[model samples]
Target: MGVVNVTPDSFSDGGEWFEPDAAVRHGLDVLAAGADLVDVGGESTRPGAERPSVEEELRRVVPVVRALAAEGAVVSVDTMRAEVARAAVEAGAAIVNDVSGGLADESMVPWVAHAGLAFVAMHWRGHSTSMQSRAVYDDVVADVCRELAERRDALLAAGIRQDLLVLDPGLGFAKTAEHNWALLAALPVLHGLGHPLLLGASRKTFLGRLGRHPGEPLRPPAERDVETTATSVLAAMAGLWCVRVHDVASTVRAIAVVEAAMEHAPEEGPA
Candidate 1:
């Protein structure tokens, strides 16, 4: 998966592709760089961001989604609104990558099932506006697993096929840096939810923080790709089903190597 931010306020690469044309171009470039899917998001879920109105979100993503789908790219709408998800899927998006895990919108699950689109149910609490307050977790791993399991049940009840589902641990949605690292280490546990896992740790704040000194200014999002790729490699080796990334070419290379090494490893089964 390749990350394509159509919104102007995402924590990373926000304004870089804010323009529709630029976003489309970036989509094409990512596909050429070996991204199997292009995730187009209109909302900036950076902590404390305001939610864009439905109209604005639609305007930001629908055209881009349409163009990419027309170009034969597998597009995923990174939205939490049923209206936007429905519109984007109608516009050619094949997947709904809702960061909210069907919590943000009442109609998202049923709509996704109705359209038979692949749905990524990312763990989320409140919307970005107040999600910071909801970040507290006594046990981050258990809490995330519990929440994701709840969402999975909702999707199943809403008529979505279990096989059409994917789970994301909501890397930076409301998680602290430590929480994010914990999730990274425990990613395999998320796969135990019985859904394919989608890891979206690319260029996140945690990676940037890792690159900074204790008292120095934090590294910027754009500068965290190398560290982010390192995490992605680890995630792949840990059995994550797919990784959402911005620098798709490098991630593809990294994943290819990981897969090759895993393939050639001596069998570890019963002798």
Candidate 2:
């Protein structure tokens, strides 16, 4: 998956593709670069970012989704609102990548179920503006896994098909740098939940922090592509079903390398 943020305030690449034409072209570029799907998000969920009204988000995303789908691209609408998801699906989105995991909108699960689209349920504690305050966790990995399990069970009870769902342990939503690293390291634990995993660590602030030197400013979001690619490769090796990234080309190449490496590895004999 490749990210196309059609908002003016996303933490990374905001305003760069805010225009519909630019966003559509970027989506095409992502597909050309080997992404299986393009995730178009009109609202910026960066920490402390303000929410956009439904009308504005619809205006920004619907056209882009329509254009991309018209071009035969698999598109995912990255939204928290059921109304936006409904509109995007009608406009040509085949997937609903709800960062809130149906927590933000009560109608989201039912709507997704009725629409029969792929659903990405991200682990979210709260909306971006207040998420930071909710980041406290005794054991970040275990807590996240438990909470995400609860969400999965709830969605199942609400009529969402298990096979149509994907889980994302949201990297930066309300997590610290340590927490993000812990989650990445615990991919196997998350995978044990019996659902396909979607890892979205592309150009996030935690990657920037990892690249920072003492007494130096953190690397910018754009500069974290290298680390993001590394994460993509590792995620692929860990059997993640997909990785959401801003720079699709690099990640595609990285996953290719991982695949080739695994393909050539010696087979194990029975222990």
Candidate 3:
């Protein structure tokens, strides 16, 4: 999956594709570069970000989704609102990538179920503005897995098709650097929840913090593509369902190398 943030305040590439035409063009560019899906989000969910009005979000997302889907791109609306999800689906979105995991909006799960679209339900604690304060976990990996399981049960109980649902661990949403690292190290535990996993570690702050010197600023989000690509290869090797990324071409190429190498490896054991 490739990210297309059609907002003026996303953590990365804000305002670069805020215009519908530009967003559609970028979506096409990502698809041509080997993205299996284009995730279009209007609201900026960066930490401490404010929510946009529903009307503004709908105006920003629907047209871009329509244009991209018309051009044969598999589109996912990265939204927390049922209203926006409904409009985007009407405009040709095939999936609803809700960061809140249908927890933020009461109407989201039902709407998604009725639409019969694929849903990526990410584990979220709260809205972006105050979510960091809620990042208290006893054991980061175990806690995240348990919480994600709860979300899975909730979504299934809400009438969403079990096969059509995907779970995301919500890497940077309400997690600390320690929490993020711990979760990444336990991908198999998350996968054991009996659902396909979606990872959105692309260009996030946690990855930027690795190897940084004391008092120095972390790597910038745009420059973290190298790190993101590494994680993309890791996700592919871990058997993840998808990896949401900002730079799709590099990740695609790297994953191709991993695939080719794995193809030649011994199936049962090392030689």
lDDT of 3 by residue, 111-205 (tens): 88987889999989999999999999999888888988988998999999999999999998889988888888888788789999999999999
Q: Give each model's clash number.
A: 0, 0, 0
Model 2 misplaced regions, further than 4 Å: none
Please identify model 3 stretches exceeding 4 Å from their true place: 269-271
Worst lDDT window (10 residues) for model 3?
A: 182-191
Better of 2 and 3 by lDDT: 2
Q: Candidate 1 residues 149-252, lDDT tens each?
A: 98889789898888899999988888888999999888778777998999989898888887568988888888888988898898888888889998998898
- The TM-score-based order of candidates, best leading, equals 2, 3, 1
Q: Given candidate 2, what's the lDDT at residue 31?
A: 96
Kindly list the per-residue Cα lDDT of model 2 for residues 1-271, writing each as its tens digit: 9999999987888589999999999999999999999999999999999999999999999999999999999999999999999999999999999999999999999988877778999999999989999999999998999999999999989888989999999999899989999998988888878999999999988888874687788888898999999999889989999999999999988898999999999999899
Better of 1 and 3 by TM-score: 3
> Candidate 1: where are CA atoms >4 Å away?
269-271
Better of 1 and 3 by lDDT: 3
- Measured over all alpha carbons after superposition, the RMSD of each candidate to the real structure, in angstroms, is 1.2, 0.8, 1.4
TM-score of candidate 1 relative to the true fold:
0.97
Candidate 1 deviation (Cα RMSD): 1.2
